[model samples]
Target: MTRDDLIAMLREQTPACGPARNALIAGADFVVWDGLVPANRHAGVFRTRMRRSLKRGRTVDGLANSVDILRRAGEEPLRTGSIDAVDRSFWFMIFLNSTATAVVACFGGRRPITMESAGL
Candidate 1:
């Protein structure tokens, strides 16, 4: 898929809360990472590094370090012209918290629908 397509998929999958709550969802150029690394190929290594760093909490420095580790893997699975295990895993790491939000935005409105209002 194209970059725009990837962004669209992410936007659709990301829930309207946490970091994406009020921010415009757009693809930032992660020159050091993004398609430069095959996340799936080095999932174990990356996960280990990420887990270690995140143990200090989700600070900017920690996330940056994690991204750096992924970057070193270089493009392969990500550059294959289709979404693969690497892409999915990397996306999951980046968007995990936002996925926690189950609240969908109100139809044609900015307000987020409450579970009570939705009668769920």
Candidate 2:
């Protein structure tokens, strides 16, 4: 899919809430980790990274969960390589938490595309 397509997909899947309750990744050069490498996930999305270490934020984990959903849906799998982490050993991932279920997507590099999805 194209960058815009991916963004749309994420946005559609994200949930909307208050300021910090929104499902969006804030940064520049946002990309999704499909595996060991950083592949171009979607364009027009935020893409930011940590120069010193990765931050443990809700958005980061959310993005990773989205990736996992894609994989489980028979789509291509995404993963965080050594570069998308603070230690270059463990893979960074995102997840979605709800009252009933939780899912682990994949790790992403840089910033994530700000998306507000409500499973639309």
Candidate 3:
């Protein structure tokens, strides 16, 4: 789909607060960054740094659980047709954002919320 199509779909389907929306926003940011900088110069480094950042001050199990949520939530948009085919960098950012958002939403609260409970 075109950029405008993607944006409209995102606005329509993404919740006010949740993993899907977080991933969409992150994907958008990645698109912008990819346009400005060569992916070879930044993508790997960014991914590694983000992983380490998420691991800091968090348990491995918590991190793993967050990752699982991210994987599920990130694919939902694509599977539902909110997004069309995208490049590897776009997918990476979606996963990164979803994972990061999940970690925050899950661990930041007294109790972890499921993807359904998160309102998608």
RMSD of each candidate? 15.0, 14.5, 14.1
Off by over 4 Å in 2: 16-27, 36-120
lDDT of 3 by residue, 11-110 (tens): 2221222333444544532232112222223334434544885666532223344344444443232111121122222121222222122112121112
Q: What is the lDDT of residue 13 in candidate 1?
A: 28
**Residue-wise lDDT of candidate 2 within 17-79, one digit each (tens)?**
111112232221233434332223411122333212245443443343343344444422234
Name the regions of candidate 1 deviating beyond 4 angstroms: 1-3, 11-39, 59-76, 80-120
**Candidate 3 Cα outliers beyond 4 Å, as residue runs:** 1-4, 8-35, 57-120
Better of 1 and 3 by lDDT: 1
Model 1 C-alpha RMSD vs. true structure (Å) is 15.0
Q: Looking at candidate 3, what is the lDDT of residue 100?
A: 23
Candidate ordering by TM-score (highest first): 1, 3, 2
Best by lDDT: 1
- lDDT for every model? 0.32, 0.31, 0.31
